[model samples]
Target: MNLAVTAAAAAGAPLLSGDKGTTSEAAVGETLVSRLGDAMLGLGSRLPDMRPETLGWELSHALTDFHTCQYTSLAVRLPRLLQAGHALTSSSDSPEPALLLAQSYTLATRMLIKLDEQQLGWMAADRARQLATAANDPLAVAEAARNLAVLGRKAHWHDAALSVALDAADDPALRTAGRRGAAQRGLLIQCAAYTAARNGDRDGMRDLTAEAASIADALGGTTLLRDHGGGFGPVTVQLHLISAENSVGDPAAALAAARALSPKALPSQERRSRYYTDVATALAHRGRRDECVRALLTAEQAAPEETHARPAVKSLISGLLVSGRTTSELRGLAARSGLLT
Candidate 1:
């Protein structure tokens, strides 16, 4: 989220073997081209050896930044790291950098989906899959599958998403009882939960959540294992429930779930913000205008950029405002959100 610090030397970036600006595959073609030029050309092999630790830290920070709704900054930063990873891979046959690159693509896939660029999201997920496969790493493949499942869900391919999640969850790599298996298992469960929600299969949603909750319980409540965007704990299971209920048009259940758990239990600012946003959406659906506005205001306080730019948030604000829900508090928020204009 730090737009002020984009210097390549400060962050470990990957080197893509291909020249810059060669393709316009991203949804916002020109915008992405411009961003990628700055993003990719600037990020070289900042570390001569490009150690996995440095890449991991840089990637983790980048992932956090993306999660916190720093899209513009990510647009200007991720390409550098991705291309830098490619450069490392081409220069040497090391799997570490490639694995990191796959992770980067996974983050990119998620971010683009949030940005509502599912076409580009699919491309990013595909790249992640290719890299993960080449690396021949089980965790990486699971991560790739997770990304693909999300992209499929967003694209309204609910059945495909469910298939991907189930396949990844059943993978021998993720079946074992260990740190990696636990993380991947938790991630796959959430993936299946959301996809089931999209399909409006209430039982499927609950079943998947129960499965994930068991993993969280076995892991002793909340453990932040740096895999699949850090949502594998008890708190995350609850958040997933809120999201699932919301997706399936169960506003009452979504609100109930949101109210039952403390946002304090959520691991990151991003998740906290999203929880409030979902609450706002459910409130809006339930015709509780004032509460909806209040929840959105709380979400904005958690992460202003995220709340402002999120499609669901924007849509909810616009809908309430357009419908003439004119409480003073709601109008104030509407003005700030540019909904009144």
Candidate 2:
């Protein structure tokens, strides 16, 4: 689960494209989304011979694929990963298997949230929490709680989302897990900050965000558990601030925050893509259409599959198409994103 390695690989990874007899990126995204929806409902078939170690190996690969934002390949891998994870939990008595299974579900929940599949996301998050709690893995349980809070915010359960995040951040086990625990707590508080912004508590967002930043400062430059927290640290905290500022209708602040850090300095392509997309959103809000397109182009370059597949990106493209002066570059980008078709 060395996400740093995956992040480095992602820098040079080729984007998925359509080829003769090959699955289109669009089709892969759709199929994976559908299958994940099915899996959340316990309707998917299981794979046999899913030993605990095998599940661990597959889970590691799955997390790597996610960190790299290799969604096309991830789509191909997740079905078997989910099925095998499910199969192992039924056959194994060890808590390790359940913890692995919980992580698998957490990964699925992350993907579902990214794809805006909130209905299925809830189920996956709940399953992750249940399995993590059953395994008595406090760290995994906190991670599961983060996903649940994210899904809660998506569903507009603002107060509940904030509570979920704050409670997990306050967990005694996580409080003592050292730097890893600190990073995890920072992540949960980061989520709470965003939820606060969404709920229109601008001051609360800043206060919570500052709290996370203080933790990041305490950790200094190291990115603990890059796979788990996506490099939660000072740089990552700034990235979230960009989004949180935008969420609170401070596009200028968001753009300013974006200007403070190079996306390349971020730990993962996923985070880099997030950096630019949030910038694009802020630019779009500020009516800087040209800058917005350029920001999106940068995001697409960082992780094409992730950039093109996100509904938020598609909506930004769609909005751009119907407003302002049209350009060949914008049209081409829109067509590639499947919004023009």
Winning candidate number (TM-score): 2
TM-score of each: 0.82, 0.91
| Model 1 residue 256 lDDT score | 93
- What lDDT tens digits, residue by residue, belong to model 1 across residues 1-341? 11112111111123233334232112222344344444434533453445667777778778877666554455545766676676677776778877888888887776666656676677777888888888887877887788889888877899989999889899887676476678678888888998999899999899989998888888886655455555577788888899899888888999899888898877677788888988877887787877878998898888776665555565676677666537777666555544454
Which 10 consecutive positions of candidate 1 have the poorest summed lDDT?
A: 1-10
Candidate 1, position 85, lDDT = 70
> In order, what lDDT does every prediction score?
0.71, 0.80
* Top model number, lDDT: 2
Give a tens-digit lDDT track for model 2, residues 1-341. Answer: 00011100011122223221234443345656766666555674454667788878877888888888887777656766777777777887888888888888889988899887888888888998999999998888999999999999988999999999999999999988888888899999999999999999999999999999999998887566733747588888899899999889899999999899888788788888999999988988888889889988998888888876777677777778776687998988877776665
TM-score of 2: 0.91
Relative to the unseen true structure, what is the Cα RMSD of model 2?
Answer: 6.8
Q: What shift in Å separates residue 105 of candidate 1 from its native position after superposition?
A: 0.7
